[model samples]
Target: MTLEENAREHPYEPVPGDVVRDAATRRVGRVMDRMGLRVQLRPLNGGREWDAMPQDLSPASQSDAMSAAVAEANAQSWRGR
Candidate 1:
């Protein structure tokens, strides 16, 4: 499919707490919440939240997903949370 079509039909459909990547800013974050037509995303490492249009984001790249998953696993192992 075309790029615009793909962007519109983005497969992720982010939910709160799920990780996502913004196309415009190239920022990877966790979905925090939704407000109207915008989605709120917070830094995966904990920081201020930002608003982004859901259509502007895609699923995190495989490498990024792996890195985040490894980090999360390590954090869970260390913190027991």
Candidate 2:
């Protein structure tokens, strides 16, 4: 099978630093690590990490990523007050 075919057979897996969404929780986070079939995700604003099943993860949309970043900035500003 061609590389493209192989890739199609295997779903895309996120690497560390990749922003993704957890469909199960409808939350956006960065991929920290992967253990077996579970993927570790940490919030864009920084917080506790959680393990999510690979099947439940999808690449975050541009809008979603921007929203997360804005939320983090807002949180930082609030804390500085």
Candidate 3:
């Protein structure tokens, strides 16, 4: 099989635009892109990006997504003050 085919057989890595959570911290961020071998994510509001392994991430639940978004908004407002 071709290398592409082999990679296709493996489990999907979160693609850019997917909302994911860090398994360790439960931090919610949107998938950015793969960096070297790590999956990159950015905060809901706008902050430094973080890298995580696909195994260390899972799709964020609706409640978790909402909470994260709210937290980000609060942070932005606080920063503006």
Q: What local lDDT score does residue 35 receive in model 3, on the 0 to 100 scale?
A: 83
Error of 1 at 3 (Å): 9.1
**lDDT digits (tens) for residues 8-81 of candidate 3:** 68755789999988986679999998988899999987799988888788788899999999999998999899
> How well is each residue in 27-53 modelled by candidate 2, as lDDT tens digits?
899999999989999999898899999
**TM-score for candidate 2, residues paired by index:** 0.75
Question: Could you give the candidate ranking by TM-score, starting with the highest?
Answer: 3, 2, 1
Between candidates 1 and 3, the one scoring higher on lDDT is: 3
Instruction: Give me the overall lDDT of model 3.
Output: 0.87
Tens digit per residue, CA lDDT, model 1, 1-81? 998788667555789878888887777888999999999987676757899998787778778866765775687678864
Best by lDDT: 2
Q: Which sections of candidate 2 miss by over 4 Å?
A: 1-8, 79-81
TM-score of every candidate relative to the true structure: 0.65, 0.75, 0.79
Give stretches of model 1 more than 4 Å off.
Answer: 1-11, 65-81
Instruction: Between candidates 1 and 2, name the one with more favorable TM-score.
Output: 2
Q: lDDT per model, in order?
A: 0.79, 0.90, 0.87
